[model samples]
Target chain A: MDNLVFERTKGLTKKEFSYCPGCTHGIIHRLVAEVLEELNVLDTAVGVASVGCSVINYEYFDCDMQQAAHGRAPAVATGIKRVNPENTVFTYQGDGDLAAIGTAEIIHAAHRNENISVMFVNNAIFGMTGGQMAPTTLPGQKTTTSQNGRDPYVVGMPIRMSEVLGQIPGAYYVERVSVHNPKHIIKAKKAIKKAFQNQIDGKGFSLVEFISTCPINWRMTPNDSLKWVEDSMIPYYPLGVVKDGDKND
Target chain B: MAKVLMKGNEAMALAAIKGGVDAFFGYPITPQNEIPEYLSRELPKLGKVFVQAESEVAAINMVYGAGGAGARVLTSSSSPGIALKQEGITYMAGSQIPGVIINVMRGGPGLGGIQPSQADYYQVTRGGGNGDYNCIVLAPENVQEAFDLVKESFDLADYYRNPVMIAADGLIGQMMAPVDIDKETPKLDLPEKDWATTGMKNRRTKENKDVDPNIIVSLSLVDTVLEEMNLVLQKKYTHMRENQQRYELINIEDAEIVIVAYGTSSRICRSAMEILKEEGIKVGMIRPITLWPFPEKAFAEIPESVKGLLTVEMSMGQMIDDVKISNNGKLPVGFYGRCGGVIPEPEEIVNAVKDFLGGLNG
Candidate 1:
């Protein structure tokens, strides 16, 4: 039996990772890299690293990558794709990058029905900046600033970007996946690959939001972090494609 | 070639599209809103790209993405809107991407006025964004130059691998002038087919198969490496300074006073120079066509016998700083201009010249 031996995908360099123990970004990144390798699009794949935790994504991916200011990767991707229209371009973003600062960019990029893909890594918190409350943070989740847990009265409900963005005609494929375990990780890889293929096939505005975990700032064990995502996060950000494919759940 | 009256702002946008710019990202601001609007309609017809970015910052970054892909991309706004774009401009400069930005100068420190002003002379010529980066700045005196310079701005941007600014005043942008769009020019086919994200993939150096997904970005955790990269950037800039200097001279021989100005204010200064000459006051005009590699040699043509220099502008006193620095404190530089949408009349500029001469000759 070929070992389901997990490893960093090929496009990712062998550089030592600085992510916290059990941080899911590494897993998500590997999955994306593996998809690139599988789809035979690695050399043609251009990624835009957005602001926030994923800003340093230029270091993670080996293919042509460019960093954009917070929340502006979608616009950057639009620029590159419009210019070349032949390259496979996608943006790697986090909730803070996509939801907070980049709300307008992603929305308009999708609205324009630009031929590109977006990988949204949502850990419900700002991981690199020491875990601030993110747009996708659970209603009652606690963080560095939200010490007493998120106040629903002030902060309001978390944003469901995949669903909201999926409403646009240009958003051809939109899905929410998680990597809390091997099973979910495999599923995420498939979803990310499909999103990229949609672009390659001339479909537009594809996105896959990964419900990831940040163990260090969650102040919980790796196992507890996974449990928290299942127990707490799911109720808020229900997974599945909002508008694409036969399955919509 | 046929000529038709066209607003400077409209001609600038038209020239960009006709010059092979396919992507335009912009946010509406005074004197330049027509640019984005024109692109919105023109790009769709040409199968080009048009995006009304969320803010000035996002608009400029979008240009960075397209430009990096080797597409001729452009963005336009007034002073305040351009201020928002400064951050993205820094990134574009650092990445050595070629792009064009048009700033229709307006009065300001804050929401100063939409009226034509050249207060941003320093902002446009010097480093507007944080970094040791500079953009090639072009100053067009009339509506026709605004159109012609937009195309030149794109070419120079690629040549220098830096952002280029067409710095014009609200007056120039709003004014109507005849232009010949049919003037034959070289084919602008600079797409790096091997690299530009263009769907046409026949040109990339590396095969698009079975390689790692690469990212195009400006962030770096390695500070030492970043410093080394900046050093390379500085070298490129030095080469650009030597290659891209542009300017014009008018009646400098035996002239005791030289009037230095650019953009809209320079046009008014031209009128003032003509008035002074008619009155038997020996004065010459020196216009800095390219503001960033500011025509320093124009001043070199000014002999030591020249008593002083006057700097006129729509801004209170921005470009005077450049004049003083370029002179190395060798000459007495006097300045006068209006701000907050108040344009300085030619007579006002003449009065300032007269006052400066009295101080220098006495």
Candidate 2:
């Protein structure tokens, strides 16, 4: 008899994903669910869903979930973590939700050294609002809002959030990874696990940023989107550990 | 419990603790800074959470998250800070997460001034935030009532699964009065927060085997679905209007003129009533404790002897709108106000009443 090697993680619900075809959000969700299941924290974990495509993430994650206002997930997660310190708390946010209107919230949350994990998904395009320009959108990347492609002089350069957050003294661990291929997917999962582990260990603040894909928003095929992330996206948003407080210790 | 001298803000903080608040999140704004300061000192001792958030926006969102997670939460601010919190407050209302917010209102229309003002009356009662939602507004006239209302506000919030506002002013926040600090606050019987996002573990295994995972969300994109949800909220509001009307009538049975006011302005109006009574001008007063319910019943029972109505406020006549609406134009209602941190003196209110009485005769 052939032994079963793998199964769906219990951290996910029976509900089907609402993400578009070839969207990397599904892979990111699977990785997070698998991490929570392996860590045995799904039952006690609480997730704050952001306002972008994953606004209905509460339906997908088999944990207590709250849908917060646009770009306010960090502040909401701070409240949850502070109120329920014993429970594992995290926020899942997109590029537009995190790097743009929520800059103050994310910066202050890191400054406060809040005991919560943040999963920052940078897709370089606003997927939910139908391909609008995101704060992390690369220069020359065409978006619905930036129809003529992003202008470096008009909008300034793309925000490197991991590097910006790594400078905060309160941030105990910060890493940026990608999920374009199997090898990179494995690496991204490891970084996500470490981020949650730091929070479980009573560390101050931990953030794991995934360079994700939005094929429909990017106006490309799923395979081309993956290749584009590896080529155009990686060159601009260099991946690797930006700050590892535990490693220093 | 014996009555003890306490500032209104301090009394509110103690009441929050006695009321079993699990978390207090706020940022320092003048006329209400004492609230956060007191909570920071006291909540930690009681094993409750207290955080001075970076901004009023973050503070209200924190309250939103804590309340969503089934924790009793509190956040306090003044006019400018309160303006920053309207976005989160609207979200909480949309999500039906219960929480308590204290607005010790200061001057406004920009960062007007940090002195007492009722300019926030329209903002609080008429829905400061966007969308078709109204938070229950509790206006307290003294330190004792402020303390009592803080505790009651939490109960009302959880009972209705909605946010409640303690709309005191700078005078109430800054002044001191005798109150029963150690009074036994009756633990109100409240419904279990089954709708709260309190983990999916046991809920997943409960009686409803086919129920989806518990989620606290406010985003309803579908038009018909949102309309249905709005109708449900409208029904709740209608119920509150019918059952939650509260007001105090003083000597209205034998008066020729009625003065309408709430919070600090009501106290001032009372002093003015005493002054007018000494002058033999028949003056009665209606102090509304619940602002949103608007105490329309009190207006309905206005004595036949009453010739006119006058509204007293610290701002330039915001609550006057509700007073007019409740009065239904049955009596000529006049307005009296002082803005930009100026408190209306008793003599000014008496003169305004005199003017209204003259207009009645004219």
**Model number with the top lDDT:** 2
On residues B15-58, what C-alpha lDDT tens digit does candidate 2 reach at each position? 99878899999999899989989999989988889998888999
- How well does candidate 2 score on lDDT at residue B296? 92
* Each prediction's number of clashing residue pairs: 25, 0
User: Over 4 Å off in model 2, which ranges?
Assistant: B184-187, B202-212
lDDT of 1 by residue, B19-116 (tens): 77868989888778888887898898988888887778778888988887878889999999988889889888887888999999888889988898
Per-residue alpha-carbon lDDT of model 2 for A1-249, expressed as tens digits?
A: 289898889989989999998898999999999999999888778899998998898889988889999989999999888887877889999999999989989999999999899999999988898999988999999999999999989999999999999999998889899999999999999998998998899987899999999999899999999999998999999999999887788
Question: How does each model score on lDDT?
Answer: 0.82, 0.90
In the range A91-140, model 1's lDDT, one tens digit per residue, is 99999899998898899888888889899999899888898998788887
Candidate 1 residue runs with Cα over 4 Å from true position: A1-16, A167-170, A245-249, B182-215
Model 2's lDDT to the true fold?
Answer: 0.90
Error of 1 at B188 (Å): 10
Candidate 2: lDDT of B178?
93
DockQ of each: 0.54, 0.75
**CA shift at B37, candidate 2, in angstroms?**
0.7
